[model samples]
Target: MTAAAAMVRVEGLCKRFSVPRREAGLRAALRALVRREYRVVEAVRDLEFSLAPGERVGFLGPNGAGKTTTLKMLAGLIVPSAGRVEVAGFTPSDRRPEFLRRVSLVMGQKRQLSWDLPAIDNFEFNRVVYEIDPVHYKRRLEELTALLDVGEVMRRPVRQLSLGERMKCELVAALLHGPQVLFLDEPTIGLDVSMQLGIREFIRRYNAEHGATVILTSHYMEDVAALCPRILVIDGGRLRFDGSIEALRRQIRPLRRVSVRAAALPDDPTAMGRVVLREGGRLVLDVAPERVPEVVGALVALPEAQDLAVHDAPLEEVMRALFGREEAADLGGAIGHAR
Candidate 1:
């Protein structure tokens, strides 16, 4: 998309830091103070991408792959070493008040709510800082509290609230000003599965209601699969893949997974395809998409074959293969599709 059509734009973005280096010994450390040894580490390099307004895009990468650094740059938290970044029509490094009011960043490990004070107090403080009209502030606050179902815990001290509760409140505080852009970094880090699902649903609802553009980073594959239709895969400080989940599967894993449940086992199952798993009266097979119909036909011919299911490979496995953690041959043919 063109820069004017996008809510967030980045071009040839790069970030470098001069990290101090010293030997292991205390004597080496003392000598380094007089003449410090430094090495340049490129956190992000030649990064380029753009997000159309209201697009829920996933930012994915391994640890230290610069996902968080990219988010920080987009949020105007730090200046980039090179390239240009624009969010909401303003340069992020400038940290203009207009830009700040239009975007919000939430890091899972960070807390904006006061520990000793109730969450409500934090909300009020944010309201004053953002100079929200009292009438609109009250109306927005009510809508958020009800949507998050955190009205009961708003009066409780933030420290006393559970992790899930605190996270919900934190989102409320960040969103009090009705930001049109959201940068979320591991927003569901330690929550249980149910809590994660709840948070994901809330984000989907909020985005649909406000048409807010969202960029999210998470290690949890389920979060990405459930919320983001388009994903940006970055590794070694560069963009590796940008496409839909289906396209990723087609690129990395072209085989179709067929699962079957039967009353008895066939003497030779390899004739059909590779047997991935075999349990009591249950079997999983990996077969080429073109051969799926034939395999299913053969399996159905068996009197003992009671049920069968077909599906694509899992997202976690696709990501692992994308990062070169697993051999591409093991994932199957139809590789070389990624750009």
Candidate 2:
């Protein structure tokens, strides 16, 4: 069997920032000037991972967890304080034209297009920057316009476009060079549900058609569920989990949720499972995964049963539990434990 190639590789990767220490009073500030005070913050700590070609992976973390910092390292925006990192056969810190031409970074909070200029103008600018051929440029523009459903908004000034429209144009600009790898940070932030789903679908189709490798950091769990098959969750400047979504869910929330609609529930439903909810003739229970069949059996045998269904806990709930557990572990001084 042929060994698979990695699109990105990172080993012992670390980033540190020097933060100044300030005092409340003027006297303290004056004393600090004579002898400065500083604190070193470790943003990323000895992280090691690799991504195979065409893999769509979610990079998740809480605020200050270094999700964006790691992305910047991969995008060549910031150099790592320690360790080795490479993307598409190039060290991102080197920022070679050839290497840069093969990857693109789209930061939702940052704008690549000029605010007063039409969105199409930004595309033209990227074409020159990447030195794309005119034929290829037009073809890519047409394809992205169709996929993102932004053909009509392309000619409008960026300032005149809606937030959703501007986001679509940004995606187009990022892809104008036909990069094989994409780094997306908070891509769906601030968009309505309909627009978020639109962006999600477009990204899915683009990945399917082009076999591009995507590494995304999104606060929206729905986006992760819809687009990423695998997820790498980081917390407290370290990787907590790295695996398929199913595996992560199973590891953190092993219990299954079984809900039933009936005329009435048992007097003490906790005997069967912990009652999750009871309202309007519906009953929800959290049962051990191994006992789901037994619990559902008892519910099925009830004469008042109207309907029954069993499923894993919602991804958001699972993730919350995971983070809570991680926090507890950190407080307990078990920082080396892997999820």
Candidate 2 on 1-339: residue-level lDDT in tens? 012388888889999999989888999899888988899999999887888889899987778889999999999989999999989889999999999999998988988889999999889989899999999999999999999989889999999999999999999999989899999999999999999999999989989999999999999999998899888888777887777777777777888999999877777889888899988788999999888888999898766897799988888898788777735344223222322
List all candidate RMSDs to the true structure.
3.2, 3.0
lDDT tens digits by residue: candidate 1, 150-201: 9989999999999999999999999999999999999999999999999999
Each candidate: how many clashes? Answer: 0, 0
Q: Measured by TM-score, how close is model 2 to the native structure?
A: 0.92
Q: In model 2, which residue pairs have backbone atoms overlapping below 3 Å?
A: none
Q: After superposition, how far is residue 153 of candidate 1 from its true place, in Å?
A: 0.7
What's model 1's lDDT at 311?
87
